[model samples]
Target: MTPMIDVVFLLIIFFLVSSHLSRRENRMPVSLADSATGISETSPADDVFTLTMDAQARLFLNGSQLSTDVFSSRLPRDSTQTVRIRVDRSLAYEHLNRVLATLTDRGFQNVSIVTSPIAVSRP
Candidate 1:
């Protein structure tokens, strides 16, 4: 009984640490573009691969900086894997397009451009 209880406590601690790390990885600083029509739905964390492009057009995969070539090489060829791109609003469209093209060429079909909900204004 003692051993079983100890194992259960260890497992609980492991899960808590891992979940916190995963959440931190996705919280990279990137000012997302605003979209009025964008839905607020998000896929399960395990099923989604997150990419971020900052204002300087620096690319990051799961909060780790990497070059475009490296990023391309790391992408899974599975078209069914969901990809979420969080790009800074100030970044140029060309940069975003390049990333999109890479994903398309890699056959990623379920890509999403993550954006912030537009703030409603009252006059």
Candidate 2:
């Protein structure tokens, strides 16, 4: 009985350590684009991927910075996967265009752009 209890305890410790080491990726802060029609919305579906670009034109996926090529490599090769681009308004159109083009060329066709609702104040 003592040996069995020791084995179980070791197994539990091993699992706890491995779980911490293998945690899922984290998401970084991204300021969404402003939209007159957009309001508070539900979270994105699990199948949908989000790509973000900050004011400095840095690209991120789930919080980690990566190049466009590296980003594409991480995605599924098929066209069925959907992605959302949360680009900073301060970024240039050319930068956004390049991102769009790259995703399209890589066969990710069903992509959406995420935006926040513009707060309208009455004078």
Candidate 3:
């Protein structure tokens, strides 16, 4: 009876600590760009087009804000450009999907999501 009671108490404490840890992660900015096996290529400046999205689902292309209509126009119609898209985890999936659909329509087949490798934080 004593061993069973101790195990139950230990489990309760473990749950309490783990719950707090998860909440802490939520308090920070949510970014989906965390990857372990990301491509390690140093692409030429001219060949890479980076698309960034904020938590509010706002899209920016190379630091310039453009509407979806204008975005489609800016992309080269004939060139098969490799675009790297970095999206915040908090942003809506629909926003990213919309941009992907547009890119596919424009014949840009090589699209990659940019992400950072997850590393252990040592305190």
Candidate 4:
């Protein structure tokens, strides 16, 4: 009985360590767009469009506040141009969806959400 218990504990320890190592190695950076793999080869445009949503649900474009209507109007007519959205993780899904809908209505198809590689620490 004692030997069996010891063997079980050893197996548990081995599995725990192996699982941790495998998980760490398998970690892939989370990206909002599927084409992120080739993003580096493409040069960012001088006129890159960006929209940011703060935790308080306030929106900003390149550090300037613009009404949703105004921002929507500023989206490029070219479908190939990318629109980047930087959103705080804590922002509500409903608010995010509303912003996405606004962009879709404006015909900005190639949109990307910007996120830090690792989650930020809460204050």
Q: Write the per-residue lDDT of candidate 4 for residues 1-123, one digit (tens) a residue.
A: 999999999999998987775344213222332331333315344445667777767677646666766867777788667776767777787888988998787677778776544334678
On residues 1-123, what C-alpha lDDT tens digit does candidate 2 reach at each position? Answer: 999999999999998976654332224565666887743435445666777888887788767888877876877666777777888777888888888888888777778787877778879
Give a tens-digit lDDT track for model 3, residues 29-84.
Answer: 43776675766747754576667777887777656577888888888665577787
What are the runs in model 1 whose C-alpha is more than 4 Å off? 119-123
Two-way TM-score contest, 2 vs 4, winner: 2
lDDT of 1 by residue, 1-123 (tens): 999999999999999988997786567888887887867656678788888899999998867899988999999767799998889999999999999999998888888988888788878
For residue 112, give model 2's deviation from the true position in Å.
0.9
lDDT of 4: 0.65
lDDT of 1 at 43: 65
- Sliding window of 10 residues with minimal summed lDDT for model 1: 36-45
Candidate order by TM-score, decreasing, is 1, 3, 2, 4
Q: What's each prediction's TM-score?
A: 0.87, 0.65, 0.66, 0.56
RMSD of 3: 17.3
Between which residue pairs do clashes occur in model 4?
none
